[model samples]
Target: MTSGPQHPTPDTHACSAHPADPSMAPAPDAERCAHGQAFEILSTCHEHIGERLGALEEVGRALRDAPELEQQHLATLGEVLAFLDTAIPIHSADEEQSLFPRLRALPTFAGAVGDTPMDCMEAEHIEHGDEKARLKAAIVTRDAGAVGRHAIALANAYRSHIAKEEEVLYPMARQLLTDPAAIADMTEEMRARRREAGLLKC
Candidate 1:
């Protein structure tokens, strides 16, 4: 096994103030991946997801505080929805196909990580899809109460989900995927999946 970079501290991901423009939020600091570069990519994607969640929470707050909806609020809702529609399914594929399979193949990881956690994660992805549909319907109907409820639910769900990946999943990926060749294979497969999904340049 190749000795690679150490796992980062959890505090490295402190949440910043919600940005006025959700699309313009600064990305997570890119890390050098001595082993699996896919972990680095996944971490950065999590940061983007976190920013969107923050924006979702802000929208929920606005809907609660005001009696009438405004154009700006609707625009922000649309912007966030557009991003979630595009980015999330691809991110899920990155984990379900590329990351989890490799991790589960390792004997040490197989027993420790087991099927339960991964099964739960996949189930949560399905839950997210259901929630996204409800959120879109609420936005279309211009129902502030429903929108606020769904936004808060989505944000809370992802915040918890991402926390588990950062704290447990990514750290274990860094530790177990120590072969340079294995890491390279994982990286290539992840990139290929993204390109096939039209999420990245081929």
Candidate 2:
């Protein structure tokens, strides 16, 4: 029962190795029992996201206080961007490609969560990309005002977004993903997704 870090590093490994491509066929029950592990992976990802959001807010404050973007501020912003640019897609695939689809397929599951919540989550995922682009552009251009504006918005949006998943979606997953084969396949797909993204080694 290894666990992920409470606060991940700048270069957190996004992928996890699995027995095989769970997408191809359901693995044996003995090998497919990682539902709790899957939840832990997502929990670790959120912890990293929350920490980075705080850092982004601090970057916003620096931009607001200074007349011009300092070199240090730029460097910090670049690191934040790099982390999110890599991490967000990997996280999204964990949800959209693996988690959400699994939850959606369970007939009993929808009554508890409904379609709207999942739909909203997907929409926010897209908005995250848009906000990240805006922030990147603002940082590249050294437009402190735009950077600050988008940073605050992105942080706020994610805060709300993550809250919903933590409160509703993940709990639902824990209850429903008890089947050994399903859990194995879902967890394997999660690893495969990050591997495809070149996240590498976990």
Whole-model Cα lDDT per candidate?
0.70, 0.68
Task: Please give, for residues 57-133, the per-residue lDDT of candidate 1 as tens digits.
Answer: 99988787666657888888888888888778777887898887876676554454534455557777899889888
Going through the candidates in order, what is the number of backbone clashes in each? 0, 0
The residue pairs in collision within model 1 are: none
User: What are the models' TM-scores?
Assistant: 0.77, 0.74
- Model 1, position 111: C-alpha lDDT score: 57
Candidate 1 vs. true structure, TM-score: 0.77
How does candidate 2 fare on TM-score? 0.74
Name the lDDT value of residue 131 in candidate 2.
89
Q: Best candidate per lDDT, number?
A: 1
Question: How many steric clashes does model 2 contain?
Answer: 0
Of the candidates shown, which would achieve the greatest TM-score relative to the real structure? 1
